[model samples]
Target: MKKRRFWTRKQWCSGILLAFFLAAQTFVLSGCGNDPAATSQEESDNLVIATSFYPMYIMVLNVTQDIPGVEAVNVTGTVTGCLHDYQLTTNDLKKIHKAQILVVNGAHMESFLDQVIAQQPELKIVDASEGIELIEDNHHEKNAHIWVSISLAMEQVQNIADQLAATDPNNAQGYQSNAQNYIRKLEELKSEMHAQLDSLEDRNIVTFHEAFPYFAQEFGLNIVATVEREPGSEPVAAELKETIDIIRQSGVRAIFVEPQYSTKAAETIATETGAQVYTLDPAVTGPEEPEAYIEIMNRNLQVLLEALGS
Candidate 1:
């Protein structure tokens, strides 16, 4: 039997057509019951984000709301509780593991964040406090609560927007727009606070903690004394005596107590100096009602002006 010679052009064309048909059949059978589009949709919907504190959380929420298919979760709860004293639960750690983006004030502010960052080396962490001028605290670092000043807070909001936009480029435009609008409101708040406190020209103010130093520095209010000689510690007897002397000598109009601690110390000073006790929430803790950063600052100014007889 003689072996057949190679096929001619017509036979070659028929062989190519058969090969193409076989490949098409294999592809259809391989994906007979699969939906790639649905798989993609499900994957896109799994993004989760978390912020460390109330102020940070609020700013993140404002920006993330406009970004489609993204959900923001705040790991820390409530405003009234001390951040340093905050205890993270197992659920908090789960959120940490699931988060794609973690926005925090900074290491100096939220020390608790250090552990989270250590555990999740791959997590994208946005330090909102970066690049802003921080007050130096020789003991460890300076005041961690920079949100007290509206001007500083405006910068913080901008930084947060930039980080979020960088992480989620698809929604960059929305983040920028939202940030601009928020900054404008903050500037307005700054002006309103200035106007509100302007009339009370020569009043002396006293606070329970040195937390209001930035606020005093910003508004030019005379902080004659702070009840707690130190930032986050109880007042010593000598410190208490000195504060009382300052109140009496300077003719201080009011004693401002923080809602985080007992008002009894301030109340006692108020009684001795004939000055009424006024509550100025540092916003380190949460508020009784709807107290955003700006709202809390506005309320503080109102209370200060009223107590000072401006």
Candidate 2:
């Protein structure tokens, strides 16, 4: 016969306590293996790229396409048009502060650049307009609208890719590959536009402002007159009369205005000169999509064909 043994209450309680302690130890070990500090370091390693405006944002988007741990954000968002007289907001400052790099059109396009550099001295800047020959604005200052020209825009993309690669050597190949892909598309568009625009006998044009000189130079269109020397400022009576006279004498049938500005001045000139008013986008502002620049430029080409093909 076998005698049955019963455990004491103290023994039972100690066994239960030991089991609980082992379970807690396992949980702590699992948590430690994950290492929250390591996760935070990985998050901080991601590159935050802040573009000064829309065009630069698009360029960065193309340059950084499909690159892991890279983000492109526009400081001025999608709605803001042109950085000519733009003022930075508090939210904008925060974005810039968090960014590891800032991509700008350069050529003095960013009026607040000096202030930004002063505030964030350690911030790396990639100027897209670097090394490209810039067209002069109405004021004789170098125009920052280099992206408006497809050829120059390709150059800017290459410049940005090169600078970004230099700044972030870890992602150098990604930047160069993406930039080359984008530049191929730009080259196709440039050839198509040149093929169409080169045959046009009527190359002289009248624009609303000084935004399109580089674009005109790319396609060999002559900008005989601009309605406004500067954006948001209407031409004076004498200046308006001079533009009308030039349009009349140049036999320019079209008066081009930007979608971002009021068409009143263009319309007034058109009414007096009997020229039709058309829209030409400078690609300063548009949809937030990466392909927005290409779409806008294609639309501009259609508008040019309609306005000038006659």
Candidate 3:
């Protein structure tokens, strides 16, 4: 109890060495716990789905709603209209590269698809219009504006859900359930539209462009004439006169124009033919909400009723 033991120099040095080694080990463990690579790895585990444009983006939103660990994004952000001659930006490429899947409205809608496939050969693609019959444009190219038709849009929705389920088996049930719920809403809208439109005597309409052939076909409305064969290309004097003549001859009372394009041509034709101008949205672009498509279609139905209802 009275004697105090002193440590040898060797023992002291060994103790110091052991303390240093323990401290270094602790520092290394803490550093690894906060590594940025670990965080990046966690983020990479998420299933990212990228859509080609606005319409497909909305479809994916409906299909993947509330599915955990699934992120849906659009390649083209806030694009105001159809992708007729759309060019991809570097940002778009980056988004596509980071995604695990790319959903597109097929049937030649995306003119840049070949370039995309060449660039990203490993990317999985889901074509929404894979099985739907497409209307041909004047140039004999398949019209890719299938989503404008509610019935056709419903089919596209189902196609998307099926492909998504096949691609991501872990969330298959969720995708199918969400698609069924959305399709039911679409069915209700279609029934309502048919009930109102089927009995109209004046079914003849003149459209601003060729965007509404599918829409006209869906409701049995005859497109007597079109103001423009292609969007953004105003009709020359001769074509305008011819369209006016056709509208007058067919007794077409309404000229339908898309919200995405200028209404100057439609207004000119309406003035010349005494037909009223109305907005019929193709839903190529609109609010970035989950229910934007349904809402836009509802508005279009009202517009049709006003323009066509006697």
Candidate 4:
């Protein structure tokens, strides 16, 4: 018999922020906080932490890898892919069983999380998305792709580290140190991106999906419109007509498209409105590729500035 789809509704509503929880369905979990480390002195076996995607995996690895007996494995793969369509095999289940701490962004981002948890509830599951406010999906009540902005990303990592340390007291100090170092880097990145954004003359741009709200908010960019009505849905005829009108009326400079999705729709828009179409990868793929999250984000800033003629 074929395996059942593992995504469940109960697993969808966890996370610390809107940005992290919204993308709780997609990849990338973000946040920032100054609360004292909320860790406990519990002991565990091997610290095997599995993540839904690259960003979460990065947060876990940076914190726990330096310590002995702690191992962080990212099951998201090396390509720019999404967790929504991901399927788990027997090998994945075996890995999950071996993990002492399962660190996931949250329930909504990977509906498959429910099945994984159901099979191994004893696993010390840490929802990095806890405590953050959630952005409601206009269509669905739950929003799952929250890690798009640097501000939110920082918040998520801090919380994840705290939870990991608390769950595994043996490595509390390591987790804390890692979290601090990573936080500093994230702050610097956010500052640099903001500075670049400040220089932009035009903040109006269109995108294939509504994935850059945090970035747009950070840089004060006006996302005049998106091609896709919702996270995964294609544009309807009426909506396409409306988008075309909005592009024409708003004088949008360029349309941003993610590599994971087809550019056909964006191409049509560009062809019709004369706006340049730029490609952006949200960094689902690991650092194995040069154009990982940070690089892609920096490149995106440059593309936006050049396209907008900032």
Candidate 5:
């Protein structure tokens, strides 16, 4: 992030004279000397949207799918799981420079957003969680992973659609229609979740991370304790013992772990408590198909039913 030096008077005169030489050379060389990258940039499409991670990319894809020449690109390089305490790469800075607008699941999840804003001050941002209600602990700390719940995910998608429609008025109709179609699919899945999980006898479970609060609330599941209190960090020995004690006292049957992170801690807890560890999709990773959100949520519900339905 070093700044380039200002050109001196002589340097500017020489540089301008050299540019005049390049222009003469371009005409003489049948335009082959012209930078192709510059030509491509000039011919680039109207809108370029950059997503912070996988879920945002997929959700924004639904709205930007039918709009021709509108690009919805994921910020490339090593973005594993959520962007909590994540460090930005050189490639990510480059991508941010190219993007006119950025979309995010923004309840402080993208901790590096301030750096991005500093790098690209004029870049417009669309925070999907701007007006949506976040799940909070009794102490009032927010759980920003709203996409784990279909109902909340629908709201985030609606907010994204509204933002995009307002930003790009010509394609407003397409964005609105696409969001409605996707929300209908999510509503169907919510109904399915109710039918599958409503009758479970024992709803108590533990989590690998504290990611499933909103998800558990959505399905009426009681999360007794999360083995790993934070993402990418193992719980201390005291914390682990406490979680195991909670599992035993609460008679929790299952420990839900997400795919993006390791299950070693959850596995250890399960061994101590005789509770089974099951994988659940938090949807931090990309979906290969268009209906990937619904498909993965259905699979997550199936895992919950099998593990928690006593």
Candidate 6:
């Protein structure tokens, strides 16, 4: 469901942060720390680790795949798009009720996290964004798209692994080993991207929105502009015109469109500037198969490689 239209983004973010703090305080009061008995007891064959969305689901799944006592589930199942506009449903609450822990993307990405906390205050939370530096827009809002960068994604995975290890000390070694192996694979992918786009003449791109600041920063590319002031919202004409002007002035050759939102705004800019529009997967959701994160990222990288003429 949409937030109350009257509330500003800053208000929503502040509320979520307050909820997180209150939830955390309750968890501490419930005595979740240093209680080996409770920790081990919770690590049963049905150790339910519920993730906020697709990205968290995949990473948690990979961490718990080999451990017989653990299982990963998405609080919202098979989300076909980004969670920025998602509303929590009764079924979502039911899933949360069955979960022992909730894994969140945690840079204000899960706007509905407060509802889950309100429902289950003692629920363990594993914030994957913990300790990772974030990209902020001029408004100082965290970009909340850390997984787009391979290096940042590695940090998130390590954070998840560390959380799992601490929660389930019985499988701590396995969690740590699995995280290292996955991290190494991600490193290889990063190297591939660097090698492929290392010498491109056209490294400037425009996004539908600010989904790729971390990605661009990591890969040494310039984001000339973003077509939309907010993802999934109709563009304000002045904002669109400003972006179009940025594209025209920068001589940017491509504008990237994400799968979750309409390409109309990007198309408008491309039409105005004679730039090509290319589709890029943000890896927000994936098929039921394993390694979905790596697969989608590789696909996005290929799209970039082709656009950059590398």
Ranking by lDDT: 2, 3, 6, 5, 1, 4
Q: Can you write out model 4's per-residue Cα lDDT over 1-310, one digit (the tens) per residue?
A: 9776664454453323334423321211111111122112111233457775777777676666456656577655553455765677766665665565677877377777687788766667788788877666456555455667777777888888889877666567888898888778778878987876787678798977766666676678888899986546678788888888999999897998887777888888888898899875565654742125566667776777678774
- Candidate 3 regions exceeding 4 Å error are 1-44, 137-139
Highest lDDT, which number? 2
Q: How would you encode candidate 1's per-residue C-alpha lDDT over 190-289 as one tens digit per residue?
A: 9998887777766688988757766777888888888875445777778778888988898888888887787777777777778888899777645323
- Deviation (Å) of 128 in candidate 5: 0.5
Error of 2 at 298 (Å): 0.7
Q: Higher lDDT: candidate 1 or 5? A: 5
What is the number of residue pairs that collide in model 3? 0
TM of each candidate vs. truth: 0.78, 0.85, 0.84, 0.78, 0.84, 0.83
Clashes of each: 5, 0, 0, 36, 0, 1
* Candidate 2 structure quality by residue, lDDT tens digits, 1-310: 8765587788899787657544533432343313434334434345678999999999999999987767788888865456767888888887886676899989998878679777887678988888787776556878778889898899999999999888777678989999999999999988889888889988989988788888998898999998888788888899999998998888999999999889999999989989999999999988877788999999999999999995
Q: What is the lDDT of candidate 3?
A: 0.83
Off by over 4 Å in 5: 1-43, 76-78
Candidate 4 differs from the real structure by a C-alpha RMSD in angstroms, to one decimal, of 11.1
lDDT at residue 96 of model 2 (Cα atoms): 83
lDDT by residue for model 3 over 91-128, one digit each (tens)?
Answer: 99878876768999898888786787777776789999
Error of 2 at 162 (Å): 0.6
Cα RMSD of all models vs. native, in order, equals 14.5, 13.8, 13.5, 11.1, 7.3, 9.7
| Model 1 weakest 10-residue run by lDDT | 27-36
lDDT of 5 by residue, 1-310 (tens): 9777799789999798657544533332342313334334432333668888878888888877766646687884335676677887888876776676799888888877787687667677988997887778877888888888888889989999999888666667888999999899889999989998899989887877778888888988888888777789989999989999998898888888888888898888889989898998888875545687888888888898788766
